[model samples]
Target: MTTAVAPPLLEDTQLGPKAGGFYRYQNIWTGLGFGIFLGFVAWLVSHATVQGSNWGTDMVVTCTMVAWVVGFNIGMGTFNAPIHWILGHDQTHEDELYAAGVGQGSSRYLKFCTDHKVVGTQYLVLVMVLFGVGGTLAMMIRTQLITPHSSFLDPQTYNAIVTIHGMVMIIATIIMVSGPFANFIMPIMIGAKDMAFPRLNAMSFWVVVSAVPCLLATFFLGGVNAGWTTYAPLSVQAPAAMDAFAMTIITFVVSVTVAGVNTIVTVVTMRAKGMTMGRLPIFTWGTVVGGALGLYAMPAFLAVMTMMITDRATGTSFFVPEVGGSQWLYENIFWIMGHPEVYVILLPPVAAVLEIASTFARKPVFGYKVAIAGFVAIAALSIMVWAHHMFTTGWAPNLAAPFMLTTELISIPTGIIFLCTIGTLWKGSIWTRLPMWFVYLFVWNFIIGGVTGIYLSDVPADQFFHGDMFVTAHFHYTLLGGAMIGATAAVCYWFPKVSGRMLNERVGKVAFWMIAIGIQVTYFGQFWEGFQGMARRIAYYNPHYETANQMSTAGAYLLMAGWLVFLYMMINGWRHGKIAPANPWHAKTLEWKVPTPVPLENFLVDPVVTSDPYTYGEGVPDGQEVPESAPAPEPELVPAGSAPGDQIDAGGAS
Candidate 1:
């Protein structure tokens, strides 16, 4: 008698055709075209009506940029559901599936696709594009600073590059891990079908896309020379570009709020039946905390930017000191959001690295609850420490003591997180992969960043370093060395599941070493310059500092080339790398159990969790021998565009 074998669940299935009617025709190109058309119309009308008025070019620029966002949304069918509700013809279920990109293939990526995976993919592309722009700008700044009195760019142009690069990198890093992994992998990790609010997920991404043009337009409008901080008095007197900068910030705030809500709701409400809070992956916890912190922090940014707009557009005194407003007031509100937002950029990637460390070390996450408590403590303390940025301002010398105390105190929770990472790696069987290489790099760099930060947190030491290249080096170490490194590890760890192919490890290692060495050389040189009392944000420097500047520039070029190599590897891997198995690392997380090229609804059967997600190493906690069954026979690889043979397994594998 022959025993029948059931078809494997880990196989791709083709989806049906699109069903959203006319909305299916609208995509990114159509949105761009419509946006340009509306912007031109607004420019013409505003130029005639408001150009020579008291508001002048600021009003005209603001009007044009706002129109572009509105038109883009309209053309992208962002208002379709609301419009349908008004017309008494709400979308059918079929339309909802089509809007989710069912069977739309590559075109779905360009459209206002509501599929969380599609949105995640879109975010990944956007992050890369932003990095490319910002890195190019960094190269320009480094080239200009390669020697004292270099004339590669005028002072105004150099300042513009600095402003744009800072904002762009900040924006990119904020969303880097949270954007792709949180939206794509987090849902599956929790054993959920999709995010609770899929349409809002799509909206969060597209809104940010709309803001990019406004930021870029600043260059043509005579540039925002007020730095990324856009301090008052300087920002108040800047050219029309300041208006565009304000619009970008306002738009970004909206995106952050929406994304924050979506992340919270999805994790809180959508986990599988038995996937309790304790069972959820560390990365999921990280994403949720980061999202929650953003909700608390971003509104402050919104308020400050809005007030700045009013100060410029309506001649309000919100930030104008001559009219009863204070520059100290501006600094206070900006840093309120500014400091917490650092954790917003930070927590997600750090969480991701812990997840990676656990997986590659073949061990459960050590002190999981303690790590969660550490994340919470850091978030709580982050908000109270903002005034530390204003320590040198002397707006409140009496308050400085408290702010410094809080700043130093935050490092305790941060240290707990570090201990958890080291504990997880202690005496474990480590599988050193591309991801783990970055993990090791993170430990090395973050120690330097953390140690330097302590000096800055002390008011006496901060007084000497406040405006110097030391402050610049310290931040780059934290943001670039720490957070960005963690994000790179996450991308490598999750690349297979996202792309259905393995990353090119050989090329990736080459890229990794280059970046590792480059970061040290680059930042160490800046640290040397700062120790020599070199001031930051200067186009020209003393001849004595030229050698340090050249060293930093040389290292910057290596960093740029390394990133380019890594980018190429990702592109090549996505197109033609070896096909990845469903559980390439034999990871225990729910996301790994799903098929590579995850299906429309992620799983055919909802996973019912039985234990904590990380059950790595051998045997039970009580030293009991776990029952072992003979391994299932290897399944043949199904060719592209074909379904596997159907056979019965009534109670499906989770």
Candidate 2:
């Protein structure tokens, strides 16, 4: 009987690679190995072509970059599809994918796990890392600006820091709203077992992961000095690091486009039987619009990057004015995607706030249909308004009014968002929970942001404001103040649901007020500076602007402190906080129908939607349908090798 114990049921870690020869594909070490090996091969060929010349240095860069991308794909098992297809081993392997790394253990956080929840958790971790990196860069910029001259970095180094920070933060914002929420929460809310394309969903996230290291490599190479927009001949003349940035951009675009398609298909094809388009959750609608915008807008920018890279690598001079190409051409193409891309990032976080508002307000979402229509209107108008960014560039005078008008027209749809939030809270049972407080914070911040934006919408105002800090202030208010605030609210509301433990309520509220006040203090000072003739993107400034600059920098530190509190709440809350029930907030949505630490497939089976997604009110009897908050069960990722009720302990000793 002792001999028949069967080696005590080895867990994944215990079942080591010792049994499987050399290649442990699921390991991160495997990927790094592949990247280094491929980079060497590329360098050898590159060295030969540019042998004994200064070009040899840049050749090593270009070769190494290509090698990194390929190696990452291979190491992460992203190439398994092609390998399976080539071998004729029945390429349909969904069964294997569905079962891979299906657990609550931290090990699944690495190595391309196919489970949506696993992927979502991984994304949450990555997004925080990006924010930390970007925030540090921002602090550095602000630190240098605390005086009248550059103290720490040369002008060129400062420009690179700014560029890197801007790109990282932009990418982070895009991921913040859509990546984790859409992949993890949307499927469950819509009553689907998984996204329409599960494997592709996994692939999209993995590729984004692969692109990060490549982008970081830019700092070590001569860093990218051109801004994130990477306009024209300026970008073409940038050092070898610009090549790294271009490759990262292409890789990111491909990842996002894949996500865009996956989200649209999933929403269109995978909803529950009774959940029609009109009955869909507002957040779902946001996801759909965001996805559609990305689908249509990303490819044009991809073309832009390809040409930009072509100009850099082979000197074709596609954007070189010396060769008779125009800088305006690049601006036109980039902003075409650029302006809509802001809306793409903006919409989902707005929707998330709306959804969170309805839940906390204990009322139906006000003007639900109108809000959907408004999202549509904003999407349509966003593409046409890209020319507004070009107003100060001395484009055709005849086009100025039309661009200004289109830019101002965007306010109408944004107004509708304000309408939804205010109307929901008008006469409802408002729980001033940490989440709803941030909703109110958004209302205040976005109003300031939108009104300031209106000032800049006029051609004269934009021309006056364009090269100064006011435009910078306006941009930050919209993206960081609006979208980023809404995104933060989503995290607070959904953190318990995701982690199976409630965040400390007291700490959350304190964090919210600090962050909101900090942003106001920070950006408001910048607004005055902008109006004071303070130039944008410069390390040194006039002494008259120093007081405002000091104010801005101090407030930024406050913002950083607030973020640190949030990080503490999340880390401490995860391990030792109160365990939450399935429906702690007592809301009636399809997602909350399951037990905490939601089941492996979300719903045990596909649920049937019975009515409109927003059913909150005094109308539905208190006890009619929504379940009471129950005690948290011992969490497990489906209780190893047993039936539903047979929950096991962490070490499987029960």
Candidate 3:
């Protein structure tokens, strides 16, 4: 009788003594630490609530709370595991369970692990939930607008709902770029096992989860009446409900910072041996630049929010104009983070669409280097253009010219992204796959969005359009056209890879057309209404605006219906769709090379690259076909305890 061979050890040696078993303990300690810190802060806040003081003490307390939340995560081993490995923890796993092509969902996904894929799904599901909530609020707002002076909701309740809707959408925007797509796809595209700092990754997500309920609590907490900007003097004078808004913003800022740091470190250090900076996928590069902006830009927002909290609670004068503080300071700092924040949300999806188009067209990205350079240019210029939002507010006229020039100049780099998309599609074999179709639509929508942006960038035109429906139309096009479409395309393209099943193509196409048409009907009416002088954020308006409002309300229903269908298709696809083979798209990326369901530790042995990822058609050789050599055929999905890497030649057997 033959003796059974011993299974190879599968410990995460790179993580040192704090590897597998210790995560449980780490979680426990982290929870305890957070509870104690929050308890003390609550005590102080209660005292301030009772005292009714006008001293600047509230600012100090809010700052202390923000510091504690941010600092504890840094201290108690959240981001420590990745840092440990990066600094030289010398253990290695040789077991089949740890190999590439193995597929197992980690406990970390259920808990808070920093795996980009887990964070990506977390962001996707979280954003979807928020989107639903925001949409519901929008329906209520429209009900009020269904007729002039209708009072479908009281002004207070209406304002609260509208404020929450805006805040939810803002948070959603932040995650749309950084969370699902960046976290999930960046590591895969860069050919890394996971994010550079996984624990920090988990920490960032958990922070957001903790903050969200508190934000939603505002509905019951006396309700924030000011819009998402929380413009002070108004915010300061509003009910205690504003406290919840301030707290949520502070928590969100902390979460964004953690994510930003993780992204920057991961891209800088963890690329595959051959994946140089220049060779990085455009989407990954977009994440890098956006992450950099988030890290630096978010602090100003945190500072401003901290000041607002202090003014509200401690009776400070930071933004109370009657108390010698300047309200404009708040506006300046808010937009400082605000405008770049838009780019932060928009850039990744644009980049993702570019990558999807290139892959689907079976061509090299037309201008890979130029595309990356464009992202860089956008990031740098985004900071300068924040003042453009302030143009109608009466800053210097000379300042207006500079802001206008910088704002218009941004279109140049943005135009390059458009050119790259068109070039990739030039005479290419166009497969009308769901993802590709969305990419084509993205190009069309973004072109319209970009051009309309020019009309707003000019100071003279903006003077007439600021705060009008025209402004509303411009942003909806940018946000919905650019960000929403990109996100849908990514979900469609990656559904098979992520879920280990194919989506229903017929249903997906139906969903796409509905959304496309719905968007046009919803926003196209707003442009004419805006040009005719209808204002946003008002519950009552003149009858002259009635026709446009009626049409917009009708379009909103269509938009909601389209999203419902899309959601249905996604759910059905996951549960009932056909089992997918690896590399269903026949693409050359390393992520698609992995086994379906993807193993716990990523790859067993490290991957070695010998072929270019963009080669297609006649350039791809027999036996060396991109899909064949990239992902070896598996007779069946590997079960637990099997050697996933043993079935195929990862780097070709020596």
Candidate with top TM-score is 1
The lDDT, on a scale of 0 to 1, for candidate 2 is 0.78
Ranking by lDDT: 1, 2, 3
- Give the alpha carbon lDDT tens digit for every residue of 33-152 in model 3: 764476467647655665554533344344444445544554343554556569785323321122211122344444455456666777788888888888888778777887878868
Task: Report backbone clashes per prediction.
Answer: 0, 1, 9
lDDT of each: 0.86, 0.78, 0.73
Query: Model 2, 26-108: lDDT tens per residue?
Result: 54666677877787788788877777765455556777777887887677766666576687754333324322453326765
Best by lDDT: 1
Q: Which of candidates 1 and 3 reaches a greater TM-score?
A: 1
What is the per-residue lDDT of model 1 for residues 1-654, given as tens digits with 9 covering 90 to 100?
223333333223343455686577899988999989999999899899875677678888888989998888878888788788899988887788888887667888999988888889999999999999999999999999998999999999999889999999999998998899999999998877789888888888998999999999999999999999998978988888999999999988888899989998888878765566667789998999999999999999999998988888878887778898999989999999999999999999999989999999998888887888889999999999999999988789999899988999999989988988998899889999999999999888888999999999999999999989998999999899999999999999999999999999999999999999999989999999999999988999999998899999999999999999999999999999999998898787888887788887786655565566677765643111111221244223223224221221111111
What shift in Å separates residue 59 of candidate 3 from its native position after superposition? 9.1
TM-score-better candidate, 1 vs 2? 1
Question: Candidate 2, after superposition: displacement of residue 458 in Å?
Answer: 0.6
Sum up the clashes in candidate 3.
9
Candidates 2 and 3: which is better by TM-score? Answer: 2
Tell how far residue 214 is off in model 3, in angstroms.
2.1
**Cα RMSDs, all models:** 7.2, 8.5, 7.7
Error of 3 at 52 (Å): 4.9
